[model samples]
Target: MKLTSTASRKLAALSLDEIKEAQQEASRQFEEFKARGLSLNMARGKPCVEQLDLALGVLEALHARSEFANSNGDDCRNYGVWNGLPEMRAIFGELLGIPDDLIILGNNSSLQMMFDCISQGYTHGYSGCEPWCRQGDVKFLCPAPGYDRHFAVTEYFGIQMIPVPMLKTGPDMDLIERLVQDETVKGCWCVPKYSNPTGVTFSDETVRRFARLKPAAKDFRIMWDNAYCVHDLTDEPDQLLNIYEECLKHGTEDQVLIFASTSKISFPGAGVAALAASKRNIDDLKLRTTVQTIGSDKLNQLRHVLFLHDADGVRSLMKGHRRILEPKFHIVLDALEQELGGLGIARWSHPHGGYFVNLDVMNGCARQVVALCKEAGVVLTDAGATFPYGADPNDSNIRIAPSFPPEEELREAMELLCIAVRLAATEKLLYERAE
Candidate 1:
């Protein structure tokens, strides 16, 4: 029997014999894929080589020694500007919609900045509050189908993580609002724009609700990670409300810590990272930085400033990225639509921007699907890596990172992945019927 016609039907509607036949066909396909000895990885959202090539000019942007001096006349070779060069701050500030004074440019990884921020809170605490470590039981509200690394940071510090369901608009605000009433809930992690895994931007109402939150802890903060602020895949991209500005209206400016970076736009390892917060919070963090180190890599900062020049320059580079990335994303989405459109076995997000596509398969089958994909040599992110502690209660929600592989490789990977999904779902149904 042709697997396409048979597999296209809902697995639940198939008879026992039909289900077994589908599984057999899937096993046969899986073995063929295994025989190909294909080796492809879709684990992390690293930019493709083509995307990295677009920023090659940046290496040459500072060839001359005289270019070492920033527009503010600070010697890039020196180590005194703890908040980063003014020109670099202004450039990222424009992209982040933050005032230059409110931003502090840091090292290459925004993840580093996030770790530092959490560490600071754990050790020294924010102004007017005791260190979180001393608080006895610290907790954070993590939005599910969220970034695993964010959960990792909180877990590393022994903070209890409370998983909040992510709605179409954003994290369930009502639950978040209720959770924050506990003084132990110190903060929440938010991707805000093109959120990790789910790719759902928080609705305006959700942003407003976040701004108006009256958490019991005076030091409660919102770790607003806008990593994909400019990584749009379409001409019409999602707009995220400025959480800081909204906080200002509600007299809660100190309640949000915003972070962004050029890790994806330029080069992941050598790009610039930054954070934005209220003056009070910035002043506190800046004072702490005085002892952390003399300053970040100013020479690299100068190179980025000279290369990117300004916000428009940043946008131009991103457009080039969108051209290469948009089609790759289409390949993944198109394959899903054609292969599993009405199978009733899976559903996924069609994000306008960001580097990931979230795919949630049949209940209790994500691990099996990921394992099958791995066995076939198409390596995927671990099945439950998107959730807290690497555990998805439903055993669903697989994050697909299509940004790294070349187009042809991505197409082949997706084909194998869809087959794995079909095979896993059929096996699951068969098991349930037998049970």
Candidate 2:
């Protein structure tokens, strides 16, 4: 009973005979390394050429000497107000269903804006308060298997990172509910829709629970990064619960902050990013940002607005992305199915949208598998890069970004990756058999 219990607990742990049989079968297929002429990368979650082709009109509109005036008539080429051009904010606000005044515009990437917000809290803090840099010992709760950049920012500021397990619907709500009780927990990172790597979306109930939570610290915030807000790779888009409405209904309107951007939709390095928050939170945050910078570039925002007028316009763009990207997703999914399906060695998500497809290899084999992929002229997002601190505690999770490369390249790289996974897993099984 004890031996069976141990064996079942770890699919990796097994007897010598079991591993020997696995290796014997695998060794038959291990051809000596051959020189190849392939140079491929399946790493970054960037948009493909065809997907970027959809937004060429935006670039054409922003050509030199155009009507580059803001709603307030500020010249697009010069410094002006800090809150961004009012018309641009209003346009995206309409796109996201929030009032324009509540949104703070930022250049292209929201990461710079988020980093600034967190840094201000570190230096001077929310609303003329004592900076955390002075207080020394600020900490944030990081949902494990989260976006690494989120963890990177908090780590850069010397903040302690507490890892919370991520689930299909969202981060573990029970753990999140209990941990934020401590005053040290300043915030939690979230990607509410079709989360990176895993392709899991937060349920409406999970969103509701998040909005209703009462943290002990008044300064506690939920960094609601909805990067994939409109990124649907399917013909039918899944309806997302309006987080702004949910927070207001649950009496935690002031407790959460929202972020969204048009990077994947329009142009990644050329799109606009915004933050949506309660009036109180906005009032508090603006106190720090208003003085530092003149404002975001109005010309860029205007281009986004002129090109994408409403929510429907934005949704229409996503449908285009879905068409070009869907086949590429199929390429990887089909490869995994043909090579490793029912092999009991690996499993990967067939995401409906978002830039990543998370893969889980047999435990302890991720590193070797990734190495083999590289050796065979394929590059992958590093093994453990998905989890906090660049360490997958389970060492099983691997992020697959299917959006960057062309379908043909993705197919080749994915094929090589599967061969590597099988080889690594079989090697693992054989090692177990020896002992």
Please count the clashing residue pairs in each candidate, in the order shown: 0, 1
Q: Write the residue-wise lDDT of candidate 1 on 344-411 in tens digits.
A: 89999999999999999999999999998888888899988888999899998899999999999999
The local lDDT score (0 to 100) that residue 285 gets in candidate 2 is 73
Q: After superposition, how far is residue 102 of candidate 2 from its true place, in Å?
A: 0.6
| Best-fitting candidate, scored by lDDT | 1
TM for candidate 1 is 0.98
lDDT of 1: 0.92
lDDT of 1 at 198: 91
The lDDT per prediction is 0.92, 0.79
Q: Write the per-residue lDDT of candidate 2 for residues 1-435, one digit (tens) a residue.
A: 221223233335445665555555444433433255567888789898888899998877777756677667778778876777676677667766688889988888888778887887787775345777876687888887889889889989998888888887789999989988887778888888888867878888888888888887677778888889888888666566777888888778877778888989898888988898889888877777777766777778777777887567888888898888888889988888777776677878877688888899999989888888787777898998887788888788888998888887888788677767777886877666559
Measured over all alpha carbons after superposition, the RMSD of each candidate to the real structure, in angstroms, is: 1.1, 4.4
